[model samples]
Target: MDTQSITGATAAEIADSIRTLHERGELRAGDALPPVRELATRLSVNRNTAVAAYRLLAQAGVVVARGRAGTVIAGMEAVAQEGYAAGSVLRDIGTGNPDPRRIPDASTALAGALGRPVLYGEPVIDPALEQRALEWVGADLPGRDLRITVTSGAVDAVERLLAQALLRDDAVALEDPCFLASIHTVRLGGYRAVPVPVDVEGMTVEGLRAALAAGVRAIICTPRAQNPTGATLSPGRAAELRAVLADHPYVLIVEDDHFSMLSQRPYETLIGPEHRRFALVRSVSKSLGPDMCLAVAATDPETAERLSLRLSPGTTWVSHILQRLVLAQLTDATALQAVAEAGRHYAERNAAFAGALTDRGLPATAADGLNLWLELPLEAKTVADRLMRRGWLARTGDEFVLGEQRSASRHLRLTVHDLTDEEAERLIDDLVDASR
Candidate 1:
């Protein structure tokens, strides 16, 4: 240890030293370093100097402090995972993944529907598809005269909802670290975002109240399969939300149930019978296929009427052929079964990886959704970059944050896919190393 007073040293020097040490393998991810007192004494610096140094590392996403675990390096200088990055690079870890091998044999469904050239002005979303969508979603929804309106996908539905329910500058409450599309949807629409913090039980009631008091007029929440954190709202949490919104009857509440059909957690409806204004949206990208780009929006009658005006003139109505294909596949018992099986496969694989991690003594794997919500001893982005270097890419929590103080989290979002036991083990080992 160099006995040099860091009090007079610049922030850049401390950062440079940390980076150099990490690159030279003098420090490894998750490898705890000496305490601030020890490091400061060894470096002949004041305690504040050492604290500042560590703070620099944390800001740069180079290290983290885990109380008694002490301070540890944050991400890998090397190592990666196997999956595909749909854009930018060919990372091995897949995003928006569907079990390709598990997709319902589209051959029969496609063939049956491919023969017709439906004329323009046909049902933007085929009626058959809408009916099937209603049935699939209706099982979970009750008492509100629900009507289904299909759109290009979940994002499309969100955009349309925002267009109809809010105007520019209106405050829309969002989960603190929300889904990427949700963040983009609100921001692109020029709506202000009020972030509500989320915890294990899902969106915190206090946070929602704060946002409501702050005067947010619209809200978008994921009842299940919330992206990034994979935090699902518990029944109690839902009830809490209903209570908060009970007085704010005018707020436009939109629940994006993207993973409704495939969620591993038990279904819980956020809409209480007396809650008058709300919409429930679900997309089939993960289960049906991303290319299908179909999502259904079930809204209150007034909202439905307003949305219809937005839909009337444009081809924005979903394509008839595509809608028919979705309907055709959805109505088939075999196709539906295949989709169910695919969901099970995702749940199983994700659970396996999470279990493997827990079994290894890191037990924070219990959660829902398609990806593993992983908190590393390292910064989430650093782990992702390291994984990328090793030929894999994982989503960092930052990508989903909609707050003004947007910062990276120590959590990584990974979608587990077809991997042999050996591959899974290797992935975890690499992650452990990458975290180091």
Candidate 2:
């Protein structure tokens, strides 16, 4: 099959032609696609048009760009599974979930939201909710022209934001040992993930520069309580990142503050005053409950306009009831107190667990978030197997790695907040033994 002969003038037409070729099995996985210049010349189209076509194909998970090596058909990308395995008898510490006991009951909030009928063509965001969100998120952002938009959750907001700004096959900088949902979102969208190594002070400066050099068009960063690593951005680190990003003003930078209300650490950001494209997302899933399915997205005017297109009436809008419920929960004095208490509980429990592990010579620390990221002496998989034998389930660090080939990761992300003192002690003992 001669893929070089494939031709179309427009991006859609070119993308369709290439997709058809793949669907018909003429171009299988790993088959090289014509370079942008060659394809443009052959089809009598501009080079940008060919680039756009390849990007479309990439967004559709059809092909991947390999820099100087050129673009090639991509194999199916893997999506990580979240939550717990069904019917598992083992104590599942791997599930990165907030304690059910801590999630505030929304019965009263639901009752309040049911007072009015929300009809179609109404405002996408409730007026009161929008004002409250603006106040809450605006105080933390560095620039003016901040616009508030609501989405189902952080994952949904990220998907829409990326879709709005980037074409498929466009490189997106993501943190190594990233959140599972972020990893899944990037792969499913067919965007090539350029990894930026994250440290105790959040994303590394060298890593961001490297990703930028790789021509990454967007970046997804967790400002605080970064999943798996639980790394928060230090003021110094945030300033350095902002300085690096200043040169790349148009790169879409998304900050997913998923642990917003639940984090003990203060919020820091990479979006500078002059940065053109940026978004900060805060989900209430951890504080209220995952079932709330609500997140507040604050972005620049243009990104907000683009995001609103998908959220416009007659297509899809967040249910007004859910919005009201979230608003009610946030506004209610009693609920706010409960949320504060929940935050402290998570911090204390995780800190206690980490301290216990360290005292036993394990050298662990719960920096922030619902889980403790422990570095093991042995390979994670080996320790995982040993843990399974001890009837405890944990998530290995390898599942969160991107663009790196380490022989093995000696890390595990375990949620120890809900465990009792005895339970934690037993698990710690088991972990210590497993690492040996």
Candidate 3:
């Protein structure tokens, strides 16, 4: 087809044409577009207009610029959303959930929260809750001018933060084996995810640097108990990442400390003190319960003000009662003890399971948080199939990968903390047999 028939004079028209071609499957994923000069000549447009057209396409997640390699189609297909899989007779180890038995009862706290009337137009966050949240989150953050915002959950806070700061198709740096919610939010928002590979010490410095060079507008990182991998950021690794990010002061940095009180490791961060745009989010779900659905966001002033636009009084404020309940549970001695004990329980159980696996001649180690990231000798799907046959269900690592690289992973994220001693032993034996 002639270039004039395929495209148009303006940048917007050219972008639309490319998008249409991609939608119609004519421009497949990884297919390179004609070079900027060639396209400009063919379309009888200025070179800058062609450049603008390509920039627009990159922003919309339709294509990616590979620097020296030229631009290629992104081919970002929506993976299956992660949540509770359908009911099965098999024991499910795939759900990345905390042990229910360990969750403290909030009945008394909920009753206390209901005693006072919470009228609209009152402060969005409870006064007492705000004080506690500031003190709690501020203790870990390095910034002096921190502002707090409360949202429905970590996912909510992240979505709002990105919406306020980024335009559609802006590149976001995300850990390769990313959290399910993070993946869903980025894809649904029409942003391209620049995959930053994660290791035992969290996101690698080189991976992050490369993403930044690719012009990522924002970064979302898990500082501890990273979902699916249970990887925590080490002190050394955190320092290295911060050094690299120092050059890009305005790039938004969001640290999702989802495991907060439940983690056995210390929280490490990537946001340097002088960093212009950043946020650290701590969710109460893992420590309290998922039903709580509360997260406190600590961010720079400008980001906080922008995030507040979406969270203001009338539109979508988190319930005051929930905030009070969280505050009550946080301060209550009994509840604190219960939460501490729960943390210990998860750590001990995971450690015991890892030891058992090691004793059985399998190389395994429990890292952190509610799940164990088990690396099997075979593909995770093969192991999952054998596990299903043996009446156990587990999440494979493939579901967590973002970007175009969809190679089968050898890892499986199993929430084995809820299993009894006997049950864990049997499962480990089954896993070993399955690998063979």
Best by TM-score: 2
Extract clashing residue pairs from model 3: 59-169, 60-169
Q: What TM-score, over all chains together, does every model reach?
A: 0.76, 0.88, 0.87
Q: What is the lDDT of residue 104 in candidate 1?
A: 78
lDDT for model 3? 0.89
Which residue segments of model 2 deviate by more than 4 Å? Answer: 1-18, 24-60, 64-75
Instruction: Candidate 1: list runs displaced more than 4 Å.
Output: 1-90, 114-125
Relative to the unseen true structure, what is the Cα RMSD of model 2? Answer: 3.8
Worst 10 residues of 2 by lDDT: 401-410
**Error of model 3, residue 86, in angstroms:** 1.6
Ranking by lDDT: 2, 3, 1
Q: Where is model 3 poorest over a 10-residue stretch in terms of lDDT?
A: 1-10
**Per-residue lDDT over 44-64 for candidate 1, one digit per residue giving the tens place of the 0 to 100 score:** 667887787887776556776
Computed on alpha carbons, the lDDT of every model, listed in order, comes to 0.75, 0.90, 0.89
List model 2 lDDT by residue over 1-24, tens digit each: 568759688999999999988888
**Residue-level error in angstroms, candidate 3, position 196:** 1.5
Deviation in Å, model 2, residue 236 alpha carbon: 0.9
lDDT of 2 at 64: 74
RMSD of 3: 3.7
